[model samples]
Target: MHRRQNVRRALLLVSFLLFPVTFYYLSPYLIIMGAGERTASGSMVVFGVMTLTALVLGRLFCGWVCPAGGLTEALFAVQNRKANNRRNWTRWLVWVPWIAVIILVTLRAGGIQRVDILYQTDHGISLTTASGMGPYIIFYAVLALIFVLSLTAGRRGFCHHTCWMAPFMMIGRGVRNTFRLPAVQLSADTPSCVGCYACTSACPMSLEVQAMVLSQRMENSECILCGTCVDVCPHNVIRYEFGRPRSTNPVRPEKP
Candidate 1:
């Protein structure tokens, strides 16, 4: 477990370093704009790829690699408070409407006639072609937004409330759950949990880990599969596994 914590920390640092470059090239706002300019935008392609990846791997992208995740993790040093994510569902309001607009724009554009992975990217890098301080100002503004949310609302507040990227992954994860497909996930042996709350304390997303451990339900859509609960458990109560879930929805037969 200690080993896993060390590995996670290393991965977090690498992700933080990659964020500036990643956001410049793959910013969601730009991607949203591209959706109307053309049918199959590079941002759309990336979103599709991310969804497919999440279908197989769950939210490991959020846990291990999201630039926003990296930023939030870095900010935890300054403010290590737990987040109140009860309003997380409100993100769907923003996501659903934006997705509807994307569809409307694509239809208005007469469908995807061409594919260009580098549509918005300037020479394959977003920062390289910035004309003036405008790009930098926007970039810093984004950073400040994330930072301020973390400082005021708690860990990953931006993720819970404002991120445009997470909803795509969450929807993909929901598809996995609905199909009961094999994916990377955490499972628990509830008998082994000591109820010490260590796992809860370590969770960056501020989930009620003890409740999840107690209920033996590690399948929450909000879970990023970061494995902090698994790592902090002195009792080895939690562990990663690959398998299909026994969905609560029962399969029904058609009328004969």
Candidate 2:
């Protein structure tokens, strides 16, 4: 395996192992429903952190630490087909209404009264606190939806089209872009691509990385910055950068 592949796999495995404890922190339903309450949920705190981090790192969390991301990559052994990029916009259909409802519910409940940060979560962990079948039902449903979607889309389909968590990070990344803030992203050198088409095939997100390089628009909202291209490139034509990428010169500079 390539170095980047190994590194990513290690990260993926760790996140997967930690998922049982981390699920509630990333729960969208908990955050939204708890929005109309006196005490806030852990998901809300995580949401705030995620959006803020997206402002600096884009979706690096997805590439490096998300449990769903880890699971999606793990399932690649079972179904490695590329995803259909079309209709990715459908996620927005779910996202907009969800946010609207959250806002409405909070308003109906009269804004936040206090911050509990531990609401609903059992001892700030999930596995030990639940004693009923309702939580189990929701847990299994979430797992079923993720696996079913991944099977259909061939790669992290839920992340692309159904994840309720992605929109907040996306919104933060958009804000970063709009303000031209110092953000971590990938920059590429298209002229040095070697025409091998390796990057595109290697992309787990099913992105046309070659096209992004050629067009000089290296940033993609769906890019997890897993560094697969950076690892696989024979010519080392792409790299991860923080803040104001040069946005030019696909060829590497020759030594004098």
**For residues 71-161, could you state the per-residue lDDT of candidate 2 as single tens digits?**
8888888988889888689899888898888788888888877776767767766656453787767777888888999999768888888
CA lDDT, every model vs. true structure: 0.77, 0.81
| Least accurate 10 contiguous residues by lDDT in model 2 | 247-256
Cα deviation of 88, candidate 2, in Å:
0.8
TM-score of 1: 0.90
49-87, model 1: which lDDT tens digit per residue?
888888988888888877778888889889989888798
* Number of clashes recorded per candidate: 0, 0
As for candidate 2, its clashing pairs are none
* Model 1 lowest lDDT segment of ten: 247-256
Q: Would you give me the overall lDDT of model 1?
A: 0.77
